[model samples]
Target: MIGFSCYLSEPADEQQTAYLKQMQQAGFTGVFTSLQLPEDDPKTLRQRLNHLITSCHQLGLAVVADISLASLKRLGIAPRDCSGIEALQLDGVRIDDGIDMTTVAALSHTMGVALNASTLSAETIDQLANAKANLRHIEAWHNFYPRPETGLDPCWFQQKNHWLHTLGFKTMAFIPGDAQQRGPLFAGLPTLEPHRGLLPLAAYLDLKRLATDHVYIGDPQLSPRSIAAFQAYTSDQVLLIQTQTADDRLYHLTWHNRPDVAQQVVRLAEARLEHIFAAPEPHHTDERPRGSITLDNTRYGRYAGELQITRCDLPADPKVNVIGHVAPVALPLLDHVGPHQALRFKQ
Candidate 1:
């Protein structure tokens, strides 16, 4: 299930409601929100949460609140208590911090529990297993780092996700949003820390190949263009490409490369498509990186029509036109495309 984050600091205005509706239209099924109760006026906080929760429910979207022990303590709430869950119309809670297996197990009975995906260790999993935690109501999710260069490593992310699966928990991770970013650099927080520079749609599609059950945009909001790209990707309407200087030749030529699922690289026969946009053949073919598409010069000459997507970084060749690379974070999705999958470009 794809989800998005909405900070409590943001207001619940009609614009926000419209954003949520747009997300729903774009194939998002869930949202993550944070809650903090005030000592002076609990009513105000309640009203805020109530409004947001009601709005999400109206759009058929589920809401999960981010909570920590400190927040619970501030609210004077019990670790396993869920007294106002129904009233608030919350679907679940993401226990961001202060994890105790026994308490987590107890909390599972009353409400759905989402553990920190990035922090769950083998020892913790064993403890939870020994405590007989309700795995059904429990899930794992990685937190987004608000600061730059603080996101988790992709290698470790895959390892952790695989580990969580063995323990019967589906894992969720986040990718930064490129549009309407909400942070220091105007790039949303992403679980794969390195993905802060990637296009939001490309990042989302890339993470899908890593077996992440849920992928969310870590920003408070996304732009309309980003929203539309996500919607198109979900519907298998396009392959979002982030082109570089080397890829200018292919980037300007907009012929769809139909995915050949069996081969992992979609083949675009330049000979078949009349509109090559008069792209010049590569004077020099460079090293082809995975997600890099190479224009085949020998197969069809200067009008080199054949394009191949590299599964991994390949040696640079003078014969083929190595135009651009598929953004690194989005590379994992190359293999999952159905045969004849459509493609799209974003420069």
Candidate 2:
């Protein structure tokens, strides 16, 4: 199924409901929302999110929400303080920190929502296993860790493949490669229909070679070229091409002045593809890094301060301490001590 991230930005509940319904009709299987709670007042946040969850459930759509330690810290509470409320909202908790397992597990128990860890790591997997929590899935880019040999390590590919099979976890990998790279990646993993941003015509055609079960065109503003390309390639082969409204300030400045162009693009693309979904806005954090390095560093630190070093000072003793007993300085011993030997004896 395809889905879009939903941001409850509208002031009125009626508008929010209408917007969600529109998204549901647009072919989104799920919606991701951001519910911020006060650290000292998680109960209030829980109440708000509960309402949103109930609303989505009524629409017969799955809902996912973000729960971050930093967001809690802003409310002046720690993860422990929000455990009870988290358990109450537990459809999914965005795993931003390594220490959120306890709260996530508690929330999962109460709300029956599986945890979806974003930007996951080996350590996070171990933590989830230790907590005995069922992790829903991981959201990552396919070219996260670049390999020197193949540009992406086949070994890492094998590891993730094995891990997914053993752990029964789903992976969502986004790719923005040209047609050449996209074809092989998609053909290699038929089950993984990656979410991709805009690409050139050549690359888009390459994507057509493989059965593109799902496609996400991030640009809201419709371009003549993009619309034409969508119409040309997305016939019967592609499943869905989800697009968002281009109402942001940046989208207007960069793409075009028309804010509604995004919707127009999606509409046109859908007309061509037949299977298209639309959302009022994009759910992803605007703070997305340009590259994998930024994403990795944001999730993990170098641990420079945690590293330790050891050093030793050598003595300037002239006498040879070769024997067990300390001997008086002797001319013969000094003659035997060459420059190299003397340097070694200094230790």
Candidate 3:
């Protein structure tokens, strides 16, 4: 199943609501909310935090809250803050700094949430594993600023692949800039042969196929032609999509004529990939909740609900509300349109 990260903006009540609504409309099930603790009183901060969680749950979104190690360090917080995990009932916590394994393990147990450590080294991985950190995943940050020369280095690529496999960690890689710039790297991989057909369907399909299950494609000025090409080529595969925005900007990198573009893209993808004939329509068990429909088809399930939409079938949503905003029309088409364009309407 595909997932999204809501890190382009900051957290707020209104932003959270809008983010959740957009995720549901887009058929996204998981969200990674970036956490930036407020400087208010701890009690007030707790209230705000609780409100954020409640808001996400109401929207049926799985919550993966991020706690930047760098931010924590800047605030002079201790590694033992991981023990304070019980305060926030998150599904997962992202330790976004290079921290020791023992600290990570302690935090994981204290919080009872999976750990996502970002951009670490092989030495770091071994140390974490030795310290018994129950890391759910690891993401390499190298791709954020991909240098063509560095990316094309066979020795570097081989070493990175070996390290990832050796660490036994699920990996996620981001592709910087346009898909065309990254297509060669994507096409160069052998494991991606099966997904070559889906290549022309989406921008950077080859990279997505070769990298981990999670792929980030960021280019503010991605053209509609490129987007159309991507959609046409990768109709068969499940892919997570997100609009890119910078902290200083109020709009997304990819400008659109309407807000529903993102939603439309998500809807079309869901309609195309969702198994129409899987099981009996999913019964509305308590687990399913109200205003939500879970459809089982293909290898994954399609969760459609007023509060959230998820393909992974996880019980929670992980989207975070960022401070930035994009034009309502700036969203991908999947957020606005339904299967076969039958449900095309404003959200």
Candidate 4:
């Protein structure tokens, strides 16, 4: 599942509705919002939220609200806040800075609850389990840090995600949006610190390797190019590659070769690039063209009938066979591929 951040406190109008529809077309299924902005009037906030939620539901988008004990008090709602939750038709509520374990356990039973992944621990899980919390209604959502240089590390995230998954909890993470920089600092809304400059689509794809259940655009806005990329990606119509430099051949090969979907990604087979398949011969024309995909031409040679994509520019050897070179865009991806990762050709 994927979602985007919504910062508006007022009800929906034509513009907001159109923007949300656009998001849905771009593969977003839901939205996450916070209601604790200092500027909002508590008296009328519920009406605004009612309109927002009702409108979102009409468009088939689920809404998740971020709330705290203080915020609820300000809204004059009870700790359980069933009326507030019901009125907004909220799909879930992230317990911002989460309350006590007792409240956490209580909320999990009646409605959906999202807890901070950073604060979730073995002790917290045990306490919740002891209280008989409904695990199905609980989700571990990573926090989107507003501060610069405070994003969580990849290794730490992987470790935490692995721990949560072991306990049967779904996990969600936020990725910074590349387009439409937010006001004030104009930085991305990111759960991880190092992802500020990464394209939103690429950020989501990279997190696929980590197996996050949901990826959200942390920023309140998105760019048309990013939205188009998501639209093409979800439909599997095209695989949009994000690269800092231009690589025409790589782009052409990927564009024409098509892409195959795996558990968490789509891959193009380098083996499919072989123009002519031939058995290796005893002739030692083992020219190892670095960074080239090649097939052996020699008969009865050790590497006969094999297509190998070179990772570097090794000296050309008599025995090495050269077929094609990866485009600049594809070069960076090669280093990150795992041996067991599935690679398939679409067309």
Could you give candidate 4's per-residue lDDT for residues 176-291 as a string of tens digits?
87666566688787887767767676677767778789998888778876787678777664545443222233434433222432322222344345533446453434454333
Q: Please give the range of 10 consecutive residues that has the lowest summed lDDT in model 2.
A: 289-298
- How many residue pairs clash (N, CA or C atoms closer than 3 angstroms) in each of the candidate models, in the order given? 7, 6, 48, 18
Candidate 2 vs 3: which has more TM-score: 3
Candidate 4 deviant stretches above 4 angstroms: 9-11, 242-347
Candidate that would win on TM-score: 1
TM-score for all models, in order of appearance? 0.76, 0.41, 0.45, 0.73
lDDT of 3 at 177: 30
What C-alpha lDDT, on a 0 to 100 scale, does residue 347 get in candidate 3?
14
Per-residue lDDT tens digits for candidate 3, residues 51-150, read 7677777877666666666545544556567645545677666665555567666675545333332345667667767878665544333233322333
Number of the top-ranking candidate, with lDDT as the measure: 1
Q: Candidate 2 clash total?
A: 6
Per-residue CA lDDT of model 2 for 200-269, tens digit only, reads 3232333233322223221112233334333433332221111222323212211111123221111111
Worst 10 residues of 1 by lDDT: 36-45
lDDT of 1 by residue, 117-174 (tens): 8777788877877888788999999988878778888888888888889888988888
Candidate 1 TM-score over all chains jointly: 0.76
